[model samples]
Target: MRRITLTEVGDRAGVSRSTASLVLRGSSKISKETARRVREAMDELGYVYDRSAANLRHARSMTLGLVMNDLRNPFLADLAVVFERSVRRAGYTVFIGYSGDDLGDQQQMLSAMVEHRIDGCLLMPAAGTERESLKVLGSHEIPSVLFARHLGGAEPYIGPDNVEAGRLLGRHLRTIGVKEAVFLGGPSPSSARAERLAGLREGFDGRVELVDGGLTDSTVSSDSGSKAVSRLLGDGTIPDCIVAYNDIIAVGVTYELRLRGFEPGSDVAVASFDDIWIASQQVPPLTSVSTHAEEVGLACAEELLAQIDEPRQNGQKLIAPSLQVRASTGSWRPRKEDR
Candidate 1:
């Protein structure tokens, strides 16, 4: 079947191709009557403009690229939804990619976006990306913004303050009268994980004992959290409270504790970051630091759009986390001794 083009629409409307282009691009220069006629002609002829070629000619793709560590994580999924809507509202489309925490994959995705000539990008970097990979994006003149996790060398980021998330969890545990807490998460290279740990330390003020229960990587999957629990038990480092990297990890910790004949709220309190939907549905609802995934997405979209309008802007933006108390953190009546 022959594809209908803008030229055909112009011919049908008794206008030139440039006028049709102006109408399609929503240029204010086109009169309302003319725009209506052009639009009617477009609908009648089934004209579909070659947006790709037009975008190339204008040096503006009207598209944004979004990269994340894993799309399976509920937090990232929610973030993606909000970001897509935000971009669409701003008259732009979005392209998303999952790097699976692989540096090579990150580089490949970046290269692909460049090939597609994306106007800007929002990246949730893989755990292992170095300064050099970030520099490549800058060199390409792509206005890239980091989301969820910050790559040290990236231009600007719109994400939760990891350190604050950790501190919130730590303080909650302490207020519940837990003197010892286990920190369960992935690798140290993960900026989110590292910042959360540091925040926890600040909250505890070196008064609480911390047991590092490391997992395979930064992915907050239930299985990884469960494995970390097993490792903690094997090392005889069980504590009065458990602070997980995120809600997924907290869920795993809760499940494993029940499997081992320990009640989550009574035997060991649990807290986590990212108030994902499941946090409230767990056996004992999870107490967690809320990173507001949707807000992060909106912020990233806004930042990218701003960069598109003003290319020389520089600096980073940090979003703080909110704390939510639940049954998982022993939110019931505190014991007499605890007071």
Candidate 2:
């Protein structure tokens, strides 16, 4: 059987299709008798309204896209919560997309968001997203705000000052008498990771010997941290400290050291970035640089809303970092010359 059409409903209601449409939309201008007749016809004919079709005519979906690289990271989980709350209060619903740090996936998800005609987007770009991939959004004139990492454009973005955060971590490890340190997990396409490494290089400048442990799996996971430790152990090189890319990696390195009969914090200090919730709950709490994920999320959301309101306005905002000292880095212990 053919699907019941709006024209049929109008015919049964003894009215024009436009009047029936206005009645179905609950327009206050519709007379009580005509509105009742249209609704009765719809019920009798079992007419199912297609909201998507109606939305296209009006031209606003009241929806926004929120795309992030890794949802497994606790920092991003927290960020999503904060960002969702702020956008919802402004009467806009969010369509979340996770790209798993893959460029193809990022492009596909962003394309879907554009096709859905979302008002705007908040993107935490994947590792290898290029200008070509983002052009899909540009072609549609869909505004986007980058979070955590950017793919290079004039669109507004909000994130932590990663270079300074890395420097902060480096100086903390150095102040604790670390003479040799291994910087684990990187060379990712993400600007955030690069900035972190650069900051660490600056912090340890002329003070400590820093070796790159290299990527174990991906730039942002504990598996990479464990792999870095394996490489170091196989090479018969163990530094006084290991600076992980994030708290997850720091936790992995801390346990890996324990399995090797090295007491973390005393024999081999471990530090990382992003003071996630688990950073302080480990056997020996992790020392880390706090990027304030929640604040960044809130700021990013606000920036996107501002852009949605005024498409021409675009800028970048950076949140400063803070150090969270814990047992993992031996911050409470008195520094003694061991060299």
Question: Please, what is the TM-score per model?
Answer: 0.79, 0.80
- On residues 111-146, what C-alpha lDDT tens digit does candidate 2 reach at each position? 898889898899888887776777677556577888
Regions of candidate 2 where Cα sits further than 4 Å from its true position: 1-58, 331-338
In order, candidate lDDTs are 0.81, 0.83
RMSD of each: 11.9, 12.7
* Model 2: lowest-lDDT 10 consecutive positions: 330-339
- Per-residue lDDT for 297 in model 1? 80
Q: Count the backbone clashes (under 3 Å) in each candidate.
A: 0, 0
